[model samples]
Target: MTLRDEITNCRICAERFAATKTRHQPRPVPWFTPTARVLIAGQAPGLRVHRSGKPFTDASGDRLRDWLGMPPEVFYDLSRVAIVPMAFCFPGYNAQGYDLPPPKVCGQTWHDRVMAELPQVRLRVLVGGAAHRYHLGTKAGVTETVQNWRAYAPDTFVLPHPSWRNTGWLTKNPWFGEEVLPALKARVKEVLND
Candidate 1:
């Protein structure tokens, strides 16, 4: 079986997820192909994506697509883009109803292997702190890391999570829109067209 198959069949997080408020089963939404040139390294699936079995199907996804300057048709095309998260399933909600962080074991078990399958990836868009930590090995906070986007641009772009919760963050970080995004969009277009 392919690496994708192995991940889809994984039940390692079954018991742990059952303990969450959602008490959901493991539904790995591994969306990628070997031919993809752009890798979207996101945090994890949210409840909507978990239910739909598609990555980036929520409001956050809409924001992400806008960030990329991509439409759904282009964003969802497996031949050109690979959507690999730090975790594959929704980690569920905490006591306060905020999303729980992705289970670390998911990355430990599958990330390297999944990356190996996508050898053609020319651009990596790391969304959120978890993805930034995993892909860029940075100890910096999201704001700092994203502020230094030029350090990794044209190849990788580290972004804060595009969730509605970060609306305040977006307002505070106007440079993200005025500076990083134009360069990012150009890079994304260049890479995808290449």
Candidate 2:
């Protein structure tokens, strides 16, 4: 069987969120894109995204939109940028008001295939340890600290999760504001214009 099909039958994640989630195809995301210049690697979707069937449709998405210096119209356009998280669905909630970690099966089964279709990706924003762990294992540190961004590849900037919970981190990491944002914007403009 094709690897993509095997990913659709993922019982590990299905045991939780999928049981209660609205019915649809087994693998819910778009899965691939060709016009994408930048890829945003986040954790799993929250309930909002699962319901909307659009990744990053919540407060976190608002932060990401701001970070990209783009509006909702542009940001949602899959032809421009791609949002492929470590997990695809709403993994349900935990006590901290945060969603659970994305299922390992999703990443282990699907990411490389999807990435294979996105050869033009000039940048990939690895947001959390889940993404950082897989995409930049040896290249970037595994501790989920935003400070280890430089250890990853060029055009790929690792970021702390953009949830409002990270407000304090953003405040503490002024270099992320002073250095990374400008560089990010510059690269974003170059990609969009190309």
Among the numbered candidates, top TM-score falls to 1
Model 2 per-residue lDDT at 121: 88
Residue lDDT tens for model 1, 148-178: 9989988999999999999999999899999
Error of 2 at 173 (Å): 1.6
| Per-residue alpha-carbon lDDT of candidate 2 for residues 12-41, written as tens digits (9 for 90 to 100) | 555565444342233455533677888888
Model 2 per-residue lDDT at 132? 78
Q: Which candidate is the best by lDDT?
A: 1
Q: Which residues of candidate 2, in runs, are more than 4 Å off?
A: 1-12, 18-27, 95-97, 138-145, 151-154
- Alpha-carbon runs more than 4 Å astray in model 1: none
Q: Please report, in order, the local distance difference test score of every candidate based on alpha carbons.
A: 0.94, 0.72
Structural similarity to truth (TM-score) of each candidate: 0.98, 0.82
RMSD of each: 0.7, 3.7
Worst 10 residues of 1 by lDDT: 93-102
What are the clash counts of all predictions, listed in order? 0, 0
lDDT, candidate 2, at 19: 46
Model 2 TM-score is: 0.82
